[model samples]
Target: MIRRTRHVPQIASSEITPETVWLNRRNLIKAAAAGTMATTLPTLASQTPDLKPLSYVPGECDGCAAEEALTPLEDATSYNNFYEFGTDKSDPAEYAHNMTIDPWSVEVSGLVNKPGKLNLEDVLSGFDLEERVYRFRCVEAWSMVVPWIGFPLADLLQRFEPTADARYVAFKTLYRPKEMRGTRSFTSVIDWPYREGLRLDEAMHPLTLMAVGLYGKTLPNQNGAPLRLVVPWKYGFKSIKSIVSIELTDQQPKTSWQELAAQEYGFFSNVNPEVDHPRWSQRYERRLPSSLFKPNRVPTQLFNGYADQVASLYTGMDLKKYY
Candidate 1:
């Protein structure tokens, strides 16, 4: 069942509502309490996840340009990926504006010498956020090119200075259920408080970004609010949202989907159309808003069409096995 806060607006409510909804003070307290408990788990302990101020330049393409022509971040961030709040892509946009960001920080722990919580400003002020045009391919069989403004994850990790023991980097999301109503439901396929990981090399890759904002504005709550990762060559899920904690460890980190199905989701989920998932074929994908009248679908590409820049990174290794 989808549990909503006790506070109800004058508008009608069924199982779901697309409009912005507010929760009662009592319900808000309960939600915050629940979120606090969720954070206690080792999985959710990040410093703080809040949107950092950023500037954006429209009509710029840096890394992946083929799909860059599709849509801009202003539309992309405001219009999609609201399933964390509800099934409606726009629900987070409506309900999440109320999200309290700032006073935010993320905890960097695990295999690092400097393992401590740092404020959002401390994190953002450390680097120059550059523009990168990367193709984002979702597991739902849809694709888009986004012009993201952020610095590389490797650059950030280098600042923290990881020990030799650091082998994989794990990331966690903020676990507030009241604001993220999707977690309050029983139907979600994702684990509560989503998590993701990358091997040390991948984490340090120039292509991996610890994004602060997009489209010349602070990232909207629906689009990760504070911090999210952007890995151009992998599936979108690998780029976890609402990052609160970054942990470096010697052991292979347990990513959310990989834990759900080891056989189906390899540690390195490289995009490969040749290797189809047992449940569905990865050979093709539907573009977003697959219009009822004119459904347009396109074939999936190996390495998400960034094979030139990233394929060599996995040289001599069987991507099928690592995938």
Candidate 2:
């Protein structure tokens, strides 16, 4: 049977969160003002120097599940998938602050009309940044709700004016050897300078975002500071972090996961409960901050619960085949 994603009503600010949690956050802010880190702050997080909270306008599903409590700031920042720093969830938050992002540049080439290394500042100079609260579903069956700040990726891609031959968008993560612990791992399986891709259409979708911050602040290094992709409908890995290159091409680019184990990882990697991972079931996800005794398993939603907006993009393709 086919399932349709539901559209929740616009939640009023008054009904968005429980009074108790709000009070708790309020108190935590007070503590932060007194030089103590807020309890809700992500673990091992470091404040980016001279960075201020970014301003944003809400998206279409602005209040999606607004009534549900957000994952604590500490947990989201401390836990991560940044293998560059290390494999452990806490590795990024602990080690990422050592890396650098200032004066960053992204090389844009391949089928694009304008091809050169563009400065990150110039790219977002006059763009209107916005905040989008999205459900983050990982292939590992753990999830979090994140308020990402950025503009639609399409807005940036359009600047290059993709040619007719540009059918796919490829991205590459930064490669810093001495500074990145994982890069020097002799026993690691992942290739350095991680790569990812999306079909041209998916890259241009309104829902696709190139995020620079989260929780209204400058993005933490561990969370792909400076630049990252946010393909909400796909598993978290699809959103490559610390992007340094974006290549538009007609031929399908080789993604890191696919190169490592094509049988296990696909190019699409869309969130589909009906399809199970090779070693585990994808039907349910563990809401994060969960411990051993309490798994907090919740039914996984199709397209990470954005099927209503993105399902049409797949048309006649079989998700299982592509996924």
Candidate 3:
């Protein structure tokens, strides 16, 4: 059954750490370790110097029915599928720290009028960031509710002025074999740079976001620090991370997974419980933070429970065929 509830409650302002306090997080951690501080904050120990407290308007869960529990920070950061770092779930958390993110830039080309290279600061400074509490569903049938800090992707794309010929938007992840161990690994199945795409309308959808951070802090290396894409209703793989280029194209770009295994991974990888994967059923999902004693499995909702907002986009189309 589909569950319906009011938007998730907003995070209290008191819970937000001030910019000064966040900047001095390391010192605070040291003080806590030395017993100089009366109250020791455990989360502070994981904070990196690059992470800054983002300024954003709190998000409302528009069509939600219940307050979804957020996955623990440790779980979210440690368990990931960034093939660039390694194939193992725990690999990204262990090796992603070796990559450099500060000198990052995104090259916007193809059908856009204002095609140029944009530095990380320029990308963030041009828009007003917002916080979105979204349900993140993976193609593997595991899920998590994440609080992401980002701006609408449409807002950024509009600035580039896509031409009339532009029908699709393509994204590419940064590829540095020297730093990204998986890229150099002989066992890797992916091409050099990971690629993903979306139809123009899908790219412009309000729910599509360019995430820079999570949990009120700048993103960790394993979590796609500096920049990443977040499309709430789609499977997690569609939201590619460590983006380095965005191209407006007329042809349907060949995505990484589709090229590797077309039957298993479709180009439009929407979350449809009715469409079972070739090897497994998609009828249910295991919510993260589950234990062997409490499996925490639940029926999977169509479009990951955003059907009211996005179902119209697929009207008169064959989801089973397209999927």
Query: Which residue runs does candidate 3 get wrong by more than 4 Å?
Result: 1-47, 60-66
Candidate 3 at residue 212, lDDT? 91
Candidate 1 segments exceeding 4 Å error: 1-53, 56-67, 72-75
Tens-place lDDT digits, model 2, residues 12-130: 88777544335456554665787756443532234434345776776654333333467877678878989998888878877787778888999999999988887877755657788
Off by over 4 Å in 2: 1-50, 61-67
lDDT of 1 by residue, 147-174 (tens): 6677788877887889998999999888
CA displacement after TM-score superposition, residue 194 of candidate 2 (Å): 0.2
Clashing pairs in 2: 41-74, 42-73, 42-74
In the range 202-288, model 3's lDDT, one tens digit per residue, is: 999888889998988778878887899998888999999999999999999999999899999998989999999899999999999
RMSD of 3: 13.0
Q: What is the C-alpha RMSD of each candidate to the true structure, in Å?
A: 10.1, 14.5, 13.0
Best by TM-score: 3
Q: After superposition, how far is residue 141 of candidate 2 from its true place, in Å?
A: 0.5
Q: What overall lDDT goes with each candidate model?
A: 0.72, 0.83, 0.85
